[model samples]
Target: MRLGIIIGSVRDGRFGEGVAQWFIPLAQESAAAAGDEVSIEVIDLKDFDLPVLTSATVPGAANKQYVDERVQRWSAAIDACDGFVFITPEYNHGVPGGFKNAFDSLGSEWAEKPVAFVSYGAEKGIRSVEHWRAIVSNFHMVDVRTQLAFSVFEDVDEQGSVAPTDSHADRARALVGDLISITGRLVTTR
Candidate 1:
């Protein structure tokens, strides 16, 4: 299975990337050691300067298109994945706009893919997960039921790595397993 983790926020002080950096590699390593041959990638929205939608652009997902080179590159990278793990942060009770814009740039890229989330924030990032799951579903993707929800006020350290909590780490590992399983099943159908 080709699994991609989309780092959800591109804000100046965002902690999302650090979390993704730790988890993506661990997932790859665990899969490798287990001989499951899972392939993982991280998709960062900052690489694609997808602007807020303008009045000049087309309106619906079917007609929407990328107007920037970054968005095009973003699509190419996303096109390589069979599933996703969205590392998200909760902001003002919702998801950040950058990730949403990245998703909007290409309508067909997400269909039939499976997705999972590792969301964190002051409020544990659960709202962000719910929001992302709905959006993924709208795009005709299946979001695995299991997820890793970390509280910004709790689990993460200043360095971006999760603190040494066996239970939390176990949950993360379980979520990754679920992601791999769902992705494998979905990809075969595709």
Candidate 2:
């Protein structure tokens, strides 16, 4: 199974990158321990360069047909993943605009897949996770309840560095475990 760890932030000095860097190894270790052949990859939104939704066709009806090459590549990447872990940052108590646009750029690629969340911001970015739950439901995606959330004030320092505690590591492992378990089941159905 391929697990895509999507770095949802694209800002110049985004904290989500640090979060992904820290979480990837833990997720890999967890997947290994789960005895599942899971390959984890970073799917950074920064690499996609997706524009705001400007397509004449609604993404749900696009059938993976996109005019722009970038969107096509993004669709292929997303289509290859069996599950996802979205590392998101809350901006103004909501999901980041770029990530949302990137998500909107594709449709069926995300359908019926499992997704987990690792978010950071005020209140540990739970608001962003909550917002994501509603949005991803449109694709009938399974949003795992076990999630890892980080507080900007508590988990980050002045240098924009992330310092996750052992407790955070524990949560990450649990999230990965649940995602893998669900993905395994979903893949069989698919």
**Which number leads on TM-score?**
2
Clashes per model (N, Cα, C within 3 A): 1, 0
The alpha-carbon deviation from the true structure for residue 26 of candidate 1, after best TM-score superposition, in angstroms, is 2.1
Cα-based lDDT at residue 60, candidate 1: 41
Ten contiguous residues minimizing lDDT sum, candidate 1: 55-64
71 in model 1: Cα distance from truth in Å? 1.3
> Given candidate 1, what's the lDDT at residue 138?
73
Tens-digit lDDT track of model 1 for 114-148:
88888888888899889888888877898889888
Relative to the unseen true structure, what is the C-alpha lDDT of residue 85 in candidate 2, on a scale of 0 to 100?
Answer: 95
Can you write out model 2's per-residue Cα lDDT over 38-81, one digit (the tens) per residue? 88888999998887899899999999999999999999999999
Candidate 1 backbone clash number: 1
